[model samples]
Target: MKRLAISLSALALCAAASAQVTITEPWVRGTVPQQKASGLFMRIDAEQHVRLLGGSSPVAGVVEVHEMAMQGEVMKMRALSHGLEIAKGHSLVLKPGGYHVMLMELKQQLKAGDRVSVTLTFEDVASKQRFTREVQAPVTALGGAQPAPAAHHRH
Candidate 1:
């Protein structure tokens, strides 16, 4: 009985430590069944200021952090080589028509209402700390009812 209690306590501690980064309201906008690309939106809350280095998902071969900006009246999207900065006690939001995670070379077709898992990596700028958080998000079709907007940040 004592051994069992100790094991359970250790498991709980590990779970908590693994989830240093909190992900909320994760959802993927709906796209054509065969669409080659799709975007993921979510909010990240960290206890301390950190940088989001990158992400990965089993559904896609490559996942990149991208930003959309208007340059010369032309909307351009570009990959951010430097990880995104997340200020302490603040939140970073990824949403449509703005900053988002681009999933490229999708390995599987994402259907509306389907749930997919994404892993996000974070690094603390001050301590050079690193951690990862996983979130399961449902895919909603484009033009579907939109979810409440998350906090936004620009590069």
Candidate 2:
């Protein structure tokens, strides 16, 4: 009976760990034929403070977390040197023209209605517990959420 109690306790702990965060609306843009790069977006609701370290997928040779920002007249997109922090009781949104996952050197093209698997690594800031959540993202077309176009045509 003591062993049974211990086993159940372990199972409960594992469930709690996985339940602290909820990832939703995971989607990737459909790439044109021969395109080697793409972006992935999603929403993460964290019950506890956590940092999104990185992501990986077999479809892409390299995966990175990136942030897009307007630097003066230039639209610059760069990888986040530090992981993105999702505060406790808050939601972090990864969308176009903002923070997102970049998938480069694709092994195959993503088509509309298709799905790809990605693993997002995260770490709890306090206890340092780390875990990964596997997300299946559907391929979607460009939506109205894109940022406004640059007002000037630079030569």
Candidate 3:
């Protein structure tokens, strides 16, 4: 009876740990066939404060977390090495013309209506723990012209 109780407790703890992070509305915007780069968007919610370590996808050879920022009249996209943070009770948004996951070195052409799978990694701040979840993204047509690379500043 004691052994059974312990086993049940462990199972419950495992279930609770896995449900801490949630992702929503994962999608990829479609681009021209020859286009080399594209953006991925999603919303991440967490029960506790956590940091997004990074992401991986089979569709692209390289996946990078990026942020768009303006510096002295020049807009630029920069790679985020430490990843984005998701505070408790808050959500993080990855959207067009904003913070995004840059999918580089495409393995196959992504077309409108196609679905892609990506895995996002999250780390718990207090526990120094990590977890990952897979998200499915559907490709859709771009709303307008592709975003241009951030302009260079000569200072």
Candidate 4:
């Protein structure tokens, strides 16, 4: 009985530690015919610090976490060599023209109202433990305006 109690306690602790990453408002930008790339935007909240490793999807052959920033008066977009970090108690907002998931080499044009399945990978900052979450993101119209950031909640 004592051993069973200990095991249950450990299991609960593991769940609390690793299952705190919440993904909300995930969406994929719709693509026009012949368009080869699109973006995935979402809000990520992590109770524990974690790194947003890149993700994969059946719709795209290549998926990368990219950032857009002004370089010498020109806007440049590039994949982050390392993943983006979400500090504990902070929310990471991914939107158009900022930090977002780049889905390239699209297999087919994504239409608005369609759904895409993407698997996002993440790593715990303290334990270096790797985990993945499956997200079903709805496709929005191409060139859709970026939405304002949602309020973040801290525990």
Candidate 5:
């Protein structure tokens, strides 16, 4: 039937959309007992041009994509309201002191060695199709993946 064919076609499209993006090295920064916020880091690879719309996690009341930059003599952090773009075949690295996921209003403390679930949403640049990928990010110590001193310091 025509309806069955159409349904199968739509299912194929959905599968393709979800397969175009891949995530690796996903992690969330460990937070102190009373800390209300933390950061999540990961590497995203795109097989097609897409935009990272943002993400959500049950552990945090609010989740957003943020960028940290040096504005003159002071460092500034701001959310990327328009989302981030990734070219086809390229990758985006979400790391500390750069682009990362801000997890605010935590429901509980995220300690090292724990895992959290984060669902990232993305939109295909050409077709405007949207999809989501759920990733399990391990909680690493605050000093886990810093720049030079990252490996040396651990609590």
Candidate 6:
């Protein structure tokens, strides 16, 4: 009984530690059955300045942090090669036509109401502190989600 209690206490501590970086309103865009890729959006709030290193999921073979912005009249999309930084007390929102998580080589299609399990990795900018958090996001309609397309963005 003591061993069980200790194990449960340890699990609780781990849950609290993993929640240091709060993930809110997490969601993945709906994709066609044949689509191979999709986008994920969420808001991250941290107590200290931190960098979003990267993330992954069982649904996709590759996951990357990406950005979408306007280059003159054309829309440009690319990976955030060095990761994205979130300042202390500031919430970093990942949405379409902005900073978002790109899921490539998806193993299956995602529809409305579906849940996605995502693991987000983070690193403290000041102390190089590292941690990861798991998020369960529900899929929403194609145009129903917030943080839609925008023009012009600077790194």
* lDDT measured at residue 20 in model 6 versus the true structure, 0 to 100: 58
- Candidate 3: give the clashing pairs: none
- Candidates ranked by lDDT, best first? 5, 4, 2, 6, 1, 3
Per-residue alpha-carbon lDDT of candidate 4 for residues 75-113, written as tens digits (9 for 90 to 100)? 999999799999999999898889999999999999876
Q: What lDDT tens digits, residue by residue, belong to model 5 across residues 1-155?
A: 99999999999998999999988778888888989999988889999999998888899998888999999989899999988899999999998899998999999999877888888889999999999889888788765663233422221
Winner on lDDT (4 vs 6): 4
Candidate 2 stretches greater than 4 Å from native = 1-14, 142-155
- How far is 19's C-alpha from truth in model 3 (Å)? 1.7
**Which stretches of model 1 miss by more than 4 angstroms?**
1-20, 145-155
Model 4 — which ten-residue stretch has the worst lDDT?
146-155
Clashes per model (N, Cα, C within 3 A)? 1, 0, 0, 0, 0, 0
Between candidates 1 and 2, which one is better according to TM-score?
Answer: 2
lDDT of each: 0.76, 0.81, 0.74, 0.84, 0.86, 0.80
lDDT of 6 at 149: 40
TM-score, predicted candidate 4 vs. hidden true structure: 0.83
The candidate that achieves the highest TM-score relative to the unseen native structure: 5
Best by lDDT: 5
Tens digit of per-residue lDDT, candidate 2, span 1-155: 99999999877866676677898777788788899999988888999998888878999998889999999999899998778899999998899889999999999988766787888888888878777788887777543232223311111
Give lDDT tens digits, candidate 6, residues 63-134.
Answer: 889999999999999998889998888888898889999989999998877887878788767756567888
lDDT for each residue of candidate 1 in 1-155, tens digit (9 for 90 to 100): 99999999877755654455677777886776677788888888776777887789999888888899999989999988887887877888888778888888887778776887888777767767566777787777675534545422211
Lowest summed lDDT over 10 consecutive residues: which window, candidate 5? 146-155
Q: Please list the residue runs of candidate 4 whose C-alpha ends up more than 4 Å from where it truly belongs after superposition.
A: 1-18, 146-155
State the local distance difference test value for candidate 3: 0.74
